[model samples]
Target: MGILQRAKPLSNIGAKQVGFTLIEMVTVILILGILVVGVSGFIIFGTRIFVESSSIDQVLSQSRFAVERMTRDIRNAVPNSVRLRTATGGSYQCIELLPIDSSTSYLELPIYPDDALVSGTVIDNGISINAGQYALVYPLASNSSGVNDVYQASRNKRFELQSSSSSANVLTLTFTGLAQFAEQSPIKRIYFASQPISYCFESPIGNSEVKLYRYADYGYIASQPAPSQMGTAVLMAENVSNNLLLEPAIKLTEQNLMRNAIVHIEPRFSVNGETFKYQHQVKVTNVP
Candidate 1:
């Protein structure tokens, strides 16, 4: 009787031990595998979207920097001295500001876009700041050939370099200066107004544009991008394109200041194929 009772309990236990058969176990594992695959796929798709979105944002930010820098220079444009105007295109960006400095008796830029004319060299008209500090951006050059063949320059010293059209191809602007500022005088500097560009991204559609205006009665602590002689360029933007629109407006003042610089820049592309458009208006100023 005891043996029969033990066998009966054993049988019951054996029956209850059927948690899952080999086939059932295989089925459960297959189901779990499917779930895992679906979850992983979802994660990968989400990650891809996030990466692409981030890339688009980055492009916009970089382009805005380029625009801000350009506009800031335009606003702080050196008056009738080193003026920036919208000619037919970039070709005439630095036209006849006449002389390189406030002192008027040095050179003559007879044409719209002046050319720097040395006896044997010709440089096209571009922007000119101070005498020793000026930039002449010419049009696209053809191989060894240059853009235009004549320009204008001036200095505090009374000397004018001119050449005829026959020698015009040889005519160009060249510069050299000599100055000995007062030493041990706290390294003094001239007061010049500055209009710096401040950049920001507002929306996904347009990420590279900003508001442009002048900051007159303000001044920049010019430092160096190169050495102590080369001043640091307060950069507002980078990654810019041809949508380079400039709308100039002036407010009532003793000297008409460029109140704002309005610009519309195109968007940047991303790996995931997204595009955006941006319009920016920036304030420019040269302050004390």
Candidate 2:
């Protein structure tokens, strides 16, 4: 009886020891592996979406800033002073314009058919006139070769200032020399301007991406200067992918008898795998 009881207890213990088989253990592990892969895929997909959206938003904000700045400058440009140029072979594009520093009506000026004078008079409008700023009168046209153009150093339409004096609200402006205006403004308005400004879109050699640069404080030149010939370049924006030969970055429609000057701004910016374009037109509001 004792031996039978001991044998029965041993058989029950052996059965308890055989808890799980290799096949069952592997089946459970396979299920857990599938669940881990599915969860990891979901996490990876969400992370990619977040990264792409952030990149797009960043591009939008930068583009808006660039467009707004350009628009404001174009709107305030000197009358008939906006001009556009593009590379013939496809490397760069630029738009140049003169910004008015101050403007007021003139009381007396030396017009055409009259002898040039060394001084002119204007009704003081509280704006201080300084030397080295150009006085423009009846600036109505732009020339490719700069003949009778505002960019010229010696033109009848504009002259450099020597000095200014104000008394009894009547301001006397002294010219650099004997100066005569080509034509008188219909409204007798005169504009004072500083240096011309140029905005260029350039691509590095062997690169397809383009960038916007602002050139200023450069003195007037009869011929438009390229990026290499400009002043210190200030970076405006980047990630441009427009082809200069096929699609120019800047275009201008000069003001005519029937319409006002319009600047067409079209720049395409690409970031990550996404791209956006601006179809903006800025109208020049100041007239001679």
Candidate 3:
């Protein structure tokens, strides 16, 4: 009886050690499942945060670059050439400019005593004259009238070089779209060059998103009633903010023949249900 009692206790202990109860196994599996879920949630949260941060960085980089480029171009634009107007059927904003690329003195006056210098106006060969290059005639004479004479002289008188006479060291010029200038005796002391630049906002079809565009090589028109379609456009930035009355606003001032402008922009983007915004202001000072 004593031997049997000892063997029975040993057998019971071995049975307990051999396998877990159903309740114990279930508790262990539940604990493991909780741990796995916690780890997975943490990893997903971390990855989402990384993606959002990267998206914000990209938006900031693109906004900064676009704003800086526009600022630089405005600062270097021809005096009194900055103009802001509504575009896209008056729903969007556009900023037009005459960016002075280069300048040179006039070699000689049109054959002289000509009515509006119809065709054969001659310019100095020293100036780089490409076919279809826009040119402005700026007289050197100081106006006693105390008016902005240089700005007045160049306005509405922008022309294109029809051809260059390399043998004669002169460029033949043509007027653009009914632009005609009367004979001014002081034409000998004049400068000529090209300036063309513009910025616009475009809204795509079936979308609320807007894009900023830059236009270049747009020849001078009598007036830019519609500037968005004026030249070859390049996309500057996408997803521009339009929450304000004027998303991209411009204000120009002229004092003592010098021109200046204030440009304000707010760029916005969305990422994973979160919206980001960046505001920038740039002051542009122009040369006379």
Candidate 4:
């Protein structure tokens, strides 16, 4: 009259436990390590490529902008006003130019050997002559002797404007003083120039990188001023690697009867051991 319970099988109790061995666990860990190393290597490689490419693109873009800006300035500069300068040991190189504010044909001018006058007549082309602007007549070159040079403050080549008035189709320009032009332009063309602009490539004393800078509104000087003596400088480009002693950064070919003036620009930029140079030439459109 008593109840009974079933017992476990003897075979099941004596069987070995079922699980992974030591060798199996080690093999799995080794495979996982290989996969991790491979994935990390791929990620590192992609990151390095992206970084290098971005650095190169940045340099290219900056260098291109600087070259184009310089080209535009040189093309529109006043005739025969482009000048180049360099230091004694080629530590720095500069190109100076005067931008023209207004240009027109002159009806009358006080040219030597005639008496100097304070007023002159020009064709009324809706030209505006602001104060502090200089009038240029027959500017042939910047390095010419006597009054033929535009950089000189001589009344024979350049003079300050005081006021301007228009009547019918004629514009009368009054000079700050009795000024006489050295020579008459064959086409009777006159130019009004604002302040001088300079682009200089300078290398720091203890640094290997050369930087390009722009200086403007610094007024005129008989001699080209260094970067330290010039007006506020704006950085244009960096990593310049030009050898000024071997070849100049800016070269000028004066205008003659055959061709217009040409400015040659050769600037080199480097980044990440990669270097590129621009061989650009800009021609002056206006002639005296």
Candidate 5:
């Protein structure tokens, strides 16, 4: 009877050890599927957010750098040298300026007396000047009494350095047109180390994929040219917005009076189906 009792308990335990039924197995599989789908969705969402944030950061950095570079250049432009141009229907688009590389005092007046006869001018001994460099000569003192007056309109004269005499501290200058300075005038030299720089928007195919270009070596004339020629276009920024009405514009104050320029830049970038925009207003003061 003991043996038979033990055998009956073992048989009951075996019956209780049955594997999972179809309903139970299907329920577990459904729960696993739900967890997998949820985890996958979270991963995808995180990746998308990371990508979008990176894109935004890249656009912001590029736009900020470009604006700051242009602002610095414009602020240091020579007095009364900032020129602005607009497209048809008064859309502001282009700006050109003469950049002042360095300024130094003239040791004395030119050895010669006549403007036409003078070919070389003397400056301070330490001033560094090179051949092919441009110079703007003006009076050091605003109230000085001489042939070279301090008035903004009358004093400044542009000349190209044909050669330099480092030992004698003289710059041999040549005039593109006529020499503007007389020989016995008190003057200072504002060297033009860089060529005339111009910033403008150019579209490759009728306003498609418009890009910002920086042109250099386009001749320097006091008056702004109509449809200014762009020489050696360098890409400043890409993927510029197409709205002509919202492009970069320059508002120049009376050059002879304030010598100020206000630059408005609204750069828009489209990245990963998202649009990013940056707007900056830079007030540039021309210091000759």
Candidate 6:
């Protein structure tokens, strides 16, 4: 049959071929739209979760790294690598290297955290411990508050020593190499504020919780009454919302004459509808 004849026969048929009505089309479109919306929501939710998790993870890692640096330096806090001696409360904490063998040794001096008082540790790195002067304090502030460090601190004069008793105390003192000396300058004393480390940490609260602190004797104290223990500030993590810093009690153990104790810094933090835990132990000592 011709093409026109075939079409005419089909057109003459009583029943028409099946096809989708407007209702069916609309229903299908509606179902697809719903599915799309659900999938989009899921994708957005997942993306948010991932971002928050990543942020939290980064924060946790940073905390660990910073603490590690602290512990490493703290362990070496000795007469040579570090100088630890009794100081009047509220005095500055110092860190410096004395050249026993070389002509000019570098002392990093009083360690200061990068941040401010509200969110920093008091532990500083620049002041040098005049190990020779720990026993005596000059201009004695009497009690504990009077003792402090008067380290050689002139930005331009890095090699110069504080002249409180520099000439009178050192009879055969030599800067180039270790020499015999009778009297070392006494650590300066003040009635308040030992050079404490101002440290910061987050509380178990929201994302912005941050605890402000100045702690040298394991806990943050407004006034360090003891002339022995001092503190400094170390900045750990920035943008910490909750102040979760713990006031830890420390003491010299009889068994461990090094006066060592470990503190497990187990903290729980929440981010993006999830809770995470961080646990680590920090070792500290109680040395007057």
Evaluated with lDDT, which candidate comes out highest?
2
Residue pairs with colliding backbones in model 3 are none
TM-score of each: 0.37, 0.82, 0.64, 0.85, 0.68, 0.42
Candidate 3 residue runs with Cα over 4 Å from true position:
1-20, 87-90, 111-127, 139-156, 163-195, 202-209, 216-219, 227-233, 244-248, 254-288
lDDT of candidate 6 vs native? 0.33
| TM-score quality measure for candidate 1 | 0.37
Instruction: Mark the 10 consecutive residues where model 4 has the least summed lDDT.
Output: 141-150
Q: Report lDDT (CA) for all predictions.
A: 0.32, 0.87, 0.58, 0.86, 0.59, 0.33
Candidate 1 lDDT trough over 10 residues, lowest sum: 180-189
- Report, for all candidates in order, the number of backbone clashes: 44, 0, 0, 0, 0, 63
lDDT digits (tens) for residues 1-288 of candidate 6: 656544433455577678999999999999999999999999999998889879878776775665565556444332212222212221222222111211211111221231211110112223323322211111111124432222222111112221112222222111222112212213311111122232324233234444322334333222333322333544454433322323221112121334444434443545455555555554443221
lDDT of 4 at 30: 100
Better of 5 and 6 by lDDT: 5
Error (Å) of candidate 1 at residue 67 is 2.4
* Residue 15 CA displacement from its true place in model 6, Å: 12
Residue 155, model 6: lDDT of: 15
Worst 10 residues of 5 by lDDT: 141-150
**Best candidate per TM-score, number?**
4
Worst 10 residues of 6 by lDDT: 114-123
Predicted candidate 1 versus true structure: per-residue lDDT over 195-226, tens digit per residue: 22222211212553332222221222121011
Candidate structures ordered by lDDT, highest first: 2, 4, 5, 3, 6, 1
As a whole number from 0 to 100, the lDDT of residue 25 in candidate 1 is 92
lDDT of 3: 0.58
List residue ranges in candidate 2 displaced over 4 A.
1-47, 143-148
Name the candidate, 1 or 5, with the larger TM-score value: 5
